[model samples]
Target: MSRALFFRLSAPLAALGRSVLGLLAAIGRVTLYAFEALSHVFRPPFYPREFAAALLNVGWLSLPVVGLTALFTGGALALQIYAGGERFSAEAVVPQIVAIGIVRELGPVLVGLMIAARVTSSIAAEIATMRVTEQIDALVTLSTHPMKYLTAPRLLAGLLVVPALVAVGDVIGIYGGFLVSTGSLGFAPGSYIQNTWDFLTRADMISSLAKGAAFGFIATLMGCYHGMNSGRGAQGVGRATKASVEAAAVLILAANFLLTNIFFAA
Candidate 1:
């Protein structure tokens, strides 16, 4: 090969290598940060006020959006399943299918995504603003640990509360499907409810809640990590906020797939 041709060919390979290295480095940093923050969870000088505020923000304040999303999704899922089942002469299976679909997949996934959009963005922007205004530095100067005060509380709250949100979303979503199946689709209310209840297993509920916890951790961790590492200006804060949401969303989806494989792959 000619020298110039060889140089051109190697350039792309070099760029790809650099990109891979950068990704690995980012993963390492995030993993380390997570370990440190989690370690602080068991340490002294805990912040109850911050932990309570986080629970309120991440769990209580998130219910309305989670409910609306789950309700609409469940209803839509019922309609689609009914319409599709018609082609196969299996419309009678709507109750079982809708129940399984919502509880096993749609409920937790939608709730997690909603949390990522709402809670993740809010956390990222708030912390990024704090970073820009030197509030985090002030905490340091006051003999406070930023991770313990800010990160640990949010992490603990996410781990505890998101599963509960998932449980609520699952119930609301199943109810929405019940409404559509019985009220609009002419399914007998008692029969539909019986079929739904009969079709769900304890393992399905466990898997759904597990996904919720993993997604919650990813959402909050991304927000804290990006916010703490944000640059020093308005533009930087904006970028960090955007990056946090994007990362949380992608990680949540990825984690969902992995968890599903673990829970249901045969």
Candidate 2:
């Protein structure tokens, strides 16, 4: 009976271990493919039109959600900071806290996560669907490098657009914080403005933008890689979409920690 039980457990354990190994192997291959795609980014026959469309799709279309999220986050952060700071008789620090939190951390991280949810899933679904339809194969047969045509444009778009989105998010977030601080918190408007400006630095803005770019790259890269390498049929597309979002979201958070350490660590 003990032998049978041991065998039953070991059988599933072995299968689980093999599945884990397969996932790691797939990730390694995808990383290599991403590097190869980057190498071809500047090669001849650049796809300007595709890149332009991608910029519009990834950047312009993403603004509303990014803006709304930043706004809500900033407002909520101000309220929380006020409540917490009041306990320590430091309620006056709301402006400075709002500015620092929105510009330095909240803005970039939220935008990254949002894009991971929105853009990564979109790219993965689109590409996976194309793969299912054999459109990718057709592109190859037509002597078109899908890497250059499809992946490069999306990659470049993500790199370029994420920073812009981050910038916009920062502005919206600061404004949101400002509104809550001045209106609900009964802080003097002029003093709040002064405190925010005095507290935030150019380094904070640059760091935020840098984080945006990194997150964007990670999000799009995961989507494109998973989509391109997805399995056969509808199940494959669904799996690719799910995996892309998960990978993008996890990587964004990890990158945030690493980047924050690099930027602010003594």
Candidate 2 per-residue C-alpha lDDT over 32-102 given as tens digits, one digit per residue, 9 for 90 to 100 = 98898888787878999999999998899999999999999989999999999999999999888888898
Model 1 clashing residue pairs (backbone) = none
Query: Which ranges of candidate 2 are over 4 A from the true structure?
Result: 1-20
- The digit string of per-residue lDDT tens for model 1 on 45-162 reads 9999999999999999999999998888888888999999999899999988888898788888898899889988888899999999999999999999999999999999988899
TM-score of 2: 0.93
Q: What is the C-alpha lDDT of each candidate?
A: 0.92, 0.91
After TM-score superposition, the amount by which residue 135's alpha carbon in candidate 2 deviates from its true location, in angstroms, is 0.5
Q: What's the distance in Å from true for residue 175, model 2?
A: 0.6
Q: Each model's number of backbone clashes? A: 0, 0
For candidate 1, report its TM-score.
Answer: 0.98
